[model samples]
Target chain A: METLFYIAAAVTLLATLRVITHVHAVHALLYLVVALIALSLIFYLLGAEFAAALEIIIYGGAIMVLFIFVVMLLGPLAVEQERTWLTPGAWVGPSILALVLLGEVGYLIVAGDLPAISIQEPRQKAVSIALFGPYIIGVELASMLLLPGLIGAYHLGRRLSSEAR
Target chain B: MSLQDLIVLTPILNLGIFCLVTMLAIAFRRNHARIAAFAFVACLLTLATLPWVASATPRAVTALLIVDRYALLYMGIVLCTTMMVIGLSYHYLHIQFRERDGIEEYYLLLLLATFGGLVLTVSVHFVSFFLGLELLGLSLCSLIGYVRTRRHPMEAAVKYLLLSISASAILLFGMALLYFESGSMTFRGVGMVVKQVQAVPGLWLGGVVLVFIGIALKLGLAPFHMWIPDVYQGAPAPITAYIATVSKGALVALLLRFVTDIGALELPSLVHLFSLLAVVSMVVGNVLALFQQNVKRLLAYSSIAHLGYLLVALLAGGPTAAEAVTFYVIVYCAMTLGSFGVVTAYSREAGDAEQFEDYRGLFWTRPWLAAMLALSLLSLAGIPVTAGFIGKFYAIAAGVDAGLWWLVLALIGNSVVSLYYYLRLVVTLFGDKPASATTPQGLAIESPQTSGWMAICSLGLVASIILIIGIYPEPLMELIRTSVSNLLMVAQQKP
Candidate 1:
């Protein structure tokens, strides 16, 4: 189980790095989706299935789709001017930061006591209760937050269609 | 829920209902554009009820939100600012949309955003906190691009949308990590677990850093502040006012709650991180603002610097810090709203009065408007006999009490640097005359007959109140002290 966690974490970290460095927005978003899914799997392994589901739905599904839609809407012809990597100074800081973070996490994995993972335990029910019982207001608030975005999208699409006419 | 819960939550509910009613009215009414005026009146009425309701009952609603004096005070500030924004929106939206398109959606978004801010002020749990932040953020994205016909507005919206998503994702990831480490998601639950758990080598630090980045992004701090200028410049004046005031205000309120509820001050690394952010934000924001020619972009950078000052108070981390932060935010809301109001009031029909050159000779044409604009700019610069001065004083004092002498000095230095650009606008208003007296093409060229005395008087009243508060600050200081005491008491009380 611990080895699986390490593998998943490594995959996520590498994928996330690719997401940033990739020149194509669609490709970057795909990498992001992959990394997000992997991270969610790791969350489930850590006994947080609820967070894992939220990660899949919110980040992987809704947000990534939004990114892709926007990219498509902008069209590939509108790609920003590319700047070549000219200096090594830029890479040095990020590289050092990444190395330090990896080292710290590696130490924790080796030194800290591990919790056992149970595959069959019912964790979804707990999350549901938390969401609906004490967290009902939060769920409602999230819906309200999405309301304006929906209206804005509608308005944008309508204006575009009308202009095209 | 009891009467106290209802009382404390009435403003939020009222605003929410206003949003729904506005939407429905738009669906049914042909003259939906005029609903904003009604919405503005409704907001003012709602604000009037807040003091009565909050004082009548101050307690937590469902244990998730606290209805204390602090929350009520900020609620009043948010509501009043929203009202001013609505007034500003009337002229700006009318000009932008003309009679061809409906603008009821803008009012709906504004009300929702204000509601989110109200929730953020009172939220005691992570659930409400994240909800409020996102609601506030998503609405702002729409507001930023409300004038979708334009290139800059669309670009600004896209930039804000992309960066905001990244920030929210990081925030969610941090919340997940913290929950996993502590086996709890609520603020109190996290506090309890943090108290019991021994140090985890990487997770704790990474979680803390991620959370800090999230807050810093929302606050538009130095390193993470790339979206500020573009968004501010692209958005319509009224929406910009909303972003500058309510959106940032909510984020600060959430940051305050998160730090206090989670006992963040107990963590040395977090304190160091915040101090570092404060220093960078102060230095970078002021330096950047000095070079901006666009009034919108300048104010955006100024907003970033003002948030830095608030951070100084936040990092102080006690009752004094709370009082100073609350007071500073209140003053910030007033100054930002008034400044944006002036911009909205004076801008051309095409929103073309954005450049510094356009403001030349504004005083000669519109003396009262120019005076109010100058007042707001002076307050933002922290000049004596203005609310900004008192707020800055409180921040410096709080920083000193926290033994952060260097931060206080940095703040003072930045305050001095800020005065140059702020005064530039003031000087331009009175000193510089336009090259030609002829009308500039594309400028909104409002006739003297169209200048609404009611709007000017309302803004003048706000400017005067700011001055009154700045000169005789004891009453507001005492109110802030009570609010701070309540917040600290609640923070210390065990759930």
Candidate 2:
């Protein structure tokens, strides 16, 4: 189980890196799906079965499909723009920064006195109760937050008619 | 929530319901002036509920929000600032959009953003914090880019959206780590764990540092301030004022609550980190402002410096610090709004009158606006006879009381350094019109009848408040002291 966990984590990290470096939006999104799936596997290994399932279903499956649909809708123009933006020179700076972050994370994991937080397989019923009871305000506020996000997306995406100008 | 909880939350609920109502109103009919007035009245109604809310002082409505005088005070500031922003937006959108353009959504987004700010002031849990922050952030992204016809606002919006999301992610990660360390998500619960701990654990310290860094980025502190000038320059002037005042003020209020609740300032490392950020922001913000040709960008840098001065009060960590910070935020909002109000009044269909050259010889033409702009600049410079001087004096006094001598000196020196650019702009406002200087028709004076007088009245009110606070700060100080004491009582009782 430990070895499998390490493999999944490594795969997630590699796929995430590919997602970042990929020039094509579709290709990057495919890599992102792979990363999400591997992340779900890690969650399963950690005994968070509900989280694993939700990660796979929501993040890996649904979000990826939506992203791919949008990429296709945007067509190949975004790919050309990405090519212009993701020049080899751009990679060097970000790669260096990522390396620095990697080193810092590695050091913290090795040296820091992190809390030994034991993971429990959270029951689905318990999660639901918490969501509806103690966290109902959060759930409501999250929905409220989505309203402006939807409005913003629609407002920005709408084409202005000549008369409007 | 119970009936009492619901009643205590009246102010936030009023704004929330009004946000939805504004949305419905826009769907029904799209009169720009009517909708602006609606938003204004909605904010006024919310402000009116504060006295009723005061009757239910220091009540924790669930684990998520606290209804106290502190929250109420900041809520009042946020609502008033939102109203002023709405007033300025009325005239701004009036000029920026024609009859056929759908500009009503700007008011919807503004109200929603203000709703988010109000939520932020009362939040005690990470869940509420993240929700409120994102709501404010996402709404602001749209508000910044509301004019899609322009390239800069869109670019600015995209920049802000990406950076803001990144910051939010960092903040979430920090919260998760802290939750891991302490097994708590509520500020009071975390405060209890911190109080009981002997030596600060590394993970907890890292989490606290990351959270502060995330907030500093949002606040446009020194190292994370790269985005401010561009966003300020690209956004509509009124929205820029909103971002500067309401958005930043909400975050400051939240940060103070979080720090006070957790007793985070007692950690030596955190104090050192804050001091470093304060000095750097002061030096970098003022020094950069000295070279700005654009008035908007100059104000952007000045805001950075002003927030740096604000951090000193935060670090002082007492009832006095709380009072000082509250007073400083109010004064800052008033002056910033007044300054941006002048810009919005002068802005035309082409773009905002952001260039320093635009205000040149303004005293010769449109003396009223020139005077308002000059007074705002003088106030921003912390000159005597302006509210800003008193704000700065309070900040320095707080810092000195806390034995933050170096920070106080840095703040005082930066105030002197800041004077040059502010005075430079003031000079430009009063300078002779060059023989070759052609007054663009956009810069030409508009009749008060066509241009909304609501904006002018709001500006006049703001300027007078600044002067009033400068001359007689006793009443405001008394109010701030009471509110701070109320907030401190809650913090003390929690542990």
Candidate 3:
């Protein structure tokens, strides 16, 4: 189990590194999908089936599709034309970030609660109850946090979209 | 939810429902004054009903929020400060910006931000804490950039947003680490677990420090203070005051609760770390302010020093320190709000009267406004009779009681140094009417509607409170003492 965990962790890191190394946004998005899938596998191995499936559906599938749309809408030529993006100057920063990420993962593997998986699995029902029970206030507050972002986004684009502008 | 839980949550819930209602009202008929009045009345009604909230003391609404006197007192401060900011903005937002179509949304955003402060005060758990902090940060991001056409405000908002978002991410990482180390999410649970472990792990200490860094970023302590002045200068005057008082005050209250909950004082080294932050923030904030010509930026830098003074009381760590922190929050809120209140009133026309020269000869033309600004500045300088003086003295007393001489001496030295800038501003206000009478722009000159009178009247109210608190602080002092004692009795007993 420990070996499998380490392999998944390494795979996730490698995929994310590949994502950054790519010049094309499309290629980066693909690498990101691989990284996220690896993460879901880790979650599944940890006995959080609900979380693993949610990760795949929301992040691996839905969010990736959205990113692809944005990249397409923005024109693939825009990124493809920037062939100079692979310069050594850019790699210096990303390499540093990659090193920091590696350190964090290594530390978590040693000290974090990444132990062997137990047999008993908590189902989605329990997750719903927990969300709706003592933690219900968090759900309500989270919506409030997003409200301003929603209102502010609409207001921001209004001036540009109007005929007056 | 139970009846008790619902009632205890009213302060937060009221603002949230009204935010929605105001949105609907705006959609149906976008009337600025009506929407503003609706939002204002909602805030006032929330304040009115706070007495009822006091009846259900120390009730934990589920596991996330605990409605107690300490939280209630801070909530009252946030709500009152928000009310004053709203009153000021009502006038400023209408006249200054010609494109007033969606400016009404600013009030909706204001109520939401206050709701954020309210959530923070009552939060006992990390989830609520982070959510509240984000709500406050996100709303301010929009509010700071409300006047979109202005290049400076846009720049300030983006800077504030990027830094704040990164800070929040770092804070979440710390929470994750702490959860891993202690195997619990609640503060009391973390304290119990950490205490039970005989030799505390290095990981635990790392988590604690990481958490502190994230908070210091929010507090705009020395290391993370680069954004303060620009954000202050760029934001509209009323929102700048909001950032100084309600926003900072909520975080301070949360930090106090977290410190006491986790029994960080038992670990003397952590106490020393806070003392170190106190000294650095005091010296750095004051020194930085000495060079600033813009009054808003000056106030921004000065607020950093003020927070450092409050930290002196916090480092003292007892009921006395808590009372000092509480009283000074009130004094700080009144003065910052009043000083910025003067700025907001004079900010009706072309540009805000921010630069020191802009305020030159202000006394000659607008004596009443000048006097209020002077009084607020004096209070900020810790001059003998104002609220700032008493707040500073009490904090020093708290440090003395704790025998923290080094920090005490630093506070004293910084206080003396800070007087130069505060007096400089006051002297500028009273300086020989600037050569050739460079006419100060805005409010008094324009025959603005009742909104002008409303904003000025609110400033007058804050000035009176400052005088009352300064001359006879007994009433406020007694209330703070009771609140601190009530909260600390639980705080010390838990660990």
What local distance difference test score does each model get? 0.79, 0.87, 0.84
Local accuracy of candidate 2 as per-residue lDDT tens digits, B345-457? 87877788898878888888778898999999999999989999999989989999989989999999999999999999999998987554256564444323234788888
On TM-score, the candidate that comes out on top is 2
Model with the higher DockQ, candidate 2 or 3? 2
Higher-scoring candidate on TM-score, 2 or 3: 2
Q: Which candidate's DockQ is highest?
A: 2
Count of backbone clashes, every candidate in sequence? 2, 0, 0
- The alpha-carbon lDDT assigned to residue B300 of candidate 2 equals 97
| lDDT tens per residue, model 3, B1-495 | 899889987877887888899989988988888988898898888887788888887777877888888888898899889888988888888776665668788888888888999998988888999999999999999888887766777888898899888889888998998898887778777777667877777777777888888999989988778888999999989999999999999999999888888878778768878888888999999999999999999999999999999999888887888898999899999999999999898875566768887777678878888899999999999998888899999999999999989999999999999999999999888877655433544323442323386798789889999999999999889878877786787665652
Q: Which stretches of model 2 miss by more than 4 angstroms?
A: A71-118, A163-165, B436-450
* Candidate 1 chain A, poorest ten consecutive residues by summed lDDT: A81-90
lDDT of 3 by residue, A39-109 (tens): 87778668787778999899988867776576566575747634454456545544554454455457557
Q: Give the DockQ (2 decimals) of all models.
A: 0.31, 0.53, 0.46
Taking chain A by itself, what TM-score does each prediction score?
Answer: 0.56, 0.69, 0.64
Q: After superposition, how far is residue A100 of candidate 3 from its true place, in Å?
A: 22
